[model samples]
Target: MCQLLGMNCNTPTDILFSFEGFHRRGGLTDHHADGWGIAFFEGRGCRLFLDDKPSADSPVAALVRAYPIQSENVIAHIRKATVGPVGLANTHPFIREMWGQYWIFAHNGDLKDYHPAPGQYFRPVGSTDSEAAFCAIMENLRQRWDAPPPLHELWEEVQSLTESIRAHGIFNFMLSNGEFLFAHCSTHLHYIVRKAPFTTAHLLDEDVTVDFANVTKPDDRVAVIATQPLTDNEHWTRIEPQQLILFKDGQPLYCS
Candidate 1:
């Protein structure tokens, strides 16, 4: 299985600090090193980077660590290659255009014998079950609505679609359309919301510490979701095994 990391903030924020620790899971701390990718959503567009190399050793990953790219919504993944071959196209954090919006998806689990019907509007370019499932969701959305629907309606549709997919196998995943982030827990997932009165935090996988209060404003709020906790000091809320949550403006709008 792979691993997922996502961030949704009320204001644009850089993920370099969190990713600095998360990327180590690619090969150093863990073994999900088949490939890796990330997407940062800015306004109506997205900045995507993918590499068929371990994030722990890839030069591209190092650049990402050094660059402070700010985004409102972000999704990242380190793949272990259960379904797709070890290649660029098989990297996680797959992206596609839907209703003129860029949607990013990343999965952390495997599907068994799952083959969905081809969609007319949305389809997968990569041969991964995660991408195929994403395409299926988009295709369903395209067929159901001509334009972007309300966030609540979209959440309902996504919840139903995730339930259907979960029937096949583990379906832990994170999705975003640059507006809101959706996370579903199949086995393992945790999150933490940081806001005013922030404190120093230390990474569990690395000897790194950051005092967020010194660097962030009083009104800044950020929600980070991951397959596992990234830090050792702060408390992370563990999501239930079968749950779907929608995060907007760095807060959980809905959970079911």
Candidate 2:
């Protein structure tokens, strides 16, 4: 299985603190070390980075840790390589264009013997079930509507499609389209929301601590989602099995 990390905020925010701990799982603190990647959404564009090396030691990962790239939505993944070879194309937080927006997706679990039909427009460049699933979702959306539907309606279709896919096996995943982030929990998935009166928090994998209040405005809100809790102090809400949640402006807008 892989590990997933996601961030959604009302204002553009850097993921340095959380990613510091999450990236450790790619080889140092945990064992999902086959490859890793991340995507940060800035307006309608996305900055994507991928590497076939362990994130804990990759120079690209080091750059990401030091850089303070701000984004409204972000998704990251550290892979353990159950279904595909250890390579760049197999690394996730995969990206594709849909409805004039970049849709980012990352999966954390395996789907046994799952093989979907070829997609009309979107297709996987990698030989992983996660990538196949992503293409299938995009194909479904492309076939369901002539254009992008409203957010709520779009979520409904996403949920239905996700449910169908989960029937094959474990399907925990995170998805985002710059505007909103959608997370589905098939197994382990947790999240924490930080807002007014933010407090200091320490990382579980490192000795780093940051008092968010010192760097953020009173109105800023941030929601962070991961395969497991990243901090040692703050409480993280564990998403229920089969649950799908939509987040915007650092708050959950819909859950089912």
Candidate 3:
């Protein structure tokens, strides 16, 4: 299994604060350390970064730390090499095109002996079950619609697709199409929402602290989801096992 970090906000926000603690988990705090990637969505486009090296030690990560790329939606992953060989292609937060928009995906669990039927519209570029599952979902969606459907309808379909794959094994994952963010927790996941009257939060992995109230606007709202809570002082609610939540404008629009 790997680790996942996602952010959805009402306005564009930089992930540097959360990423600081998360990157350390690749080799310093937790030792997943195989490959890592991150994607930030700006309108219809995405800025993606990937590396086969440990995120903590990867030279690519230095640029990530320096660049304050802001986005309304973001996804990141650090691999632990469960099924795929270490390489850039195997790094996660995989991206694909669908319905004239880009989609980003990342998984944090293992599917035992899972294999998917070949898809005409989408296929895994890498040999990991995570990517296979992603392609499967994309293929299924493409089969169901020629164009983008309503958010509510698409959300239900995505939820159903995820439920079908849950039988294979642990299936915690995050998906986004820039407009909405979906998170499914098969085992463990936690999320925190920061907004008006924000408070100071301290990273559990690093010796850094941020006073969010001082840095953010009064109306800014951001939802941060991770395999584990990144901050020690904030009250992060654990997403119940097997529950799927859809977030929009930094709010949980639906949960099931």
Candidate 1 local lDDT, 48-149, one digit each (tens): 999999999999999999999989999999999999789988887888888889999999888898999888998788899999999998899889999999
211-237: candidate 3 lDDT, tens digit per residue = 998889998999999999999998999
Q: Against the hidden reference, what TM-scores do the models get?
A: 0.99, 0.98, 0.98
The backbone clash count of each candidate, in order, is 0, 0, 0
How far out, in Å, is residue 220 in model 2? 0.4
Off by over 4 Å in 1: none
Q: Which ten residues in a row are the worst by lDDT in model 3?
A: 82-91
The 10 consecutive residues of candidate 1 with the worst lDDT sum are: 89-98
RMSD in order of candidates: 0.7, 0.8, 0.9
Structural RMSD, model 2: 0.8
Clashes in predicted model 1: 0
Model 3: residue 114 alpha-carbon error in angstroms: 1.8
Stretches of candidate 2 exceeding 4 Å from the true structure: none
Question: Model-by-model lDDT, in order?
Answer: 0.92, 0.94, 0.92
In model 3, the Cα lDDT at residue 65 comes to: 86
- The TM-score of candidate 1 is 0.99
TM-score: model 2 vs. ground truth? 0.98
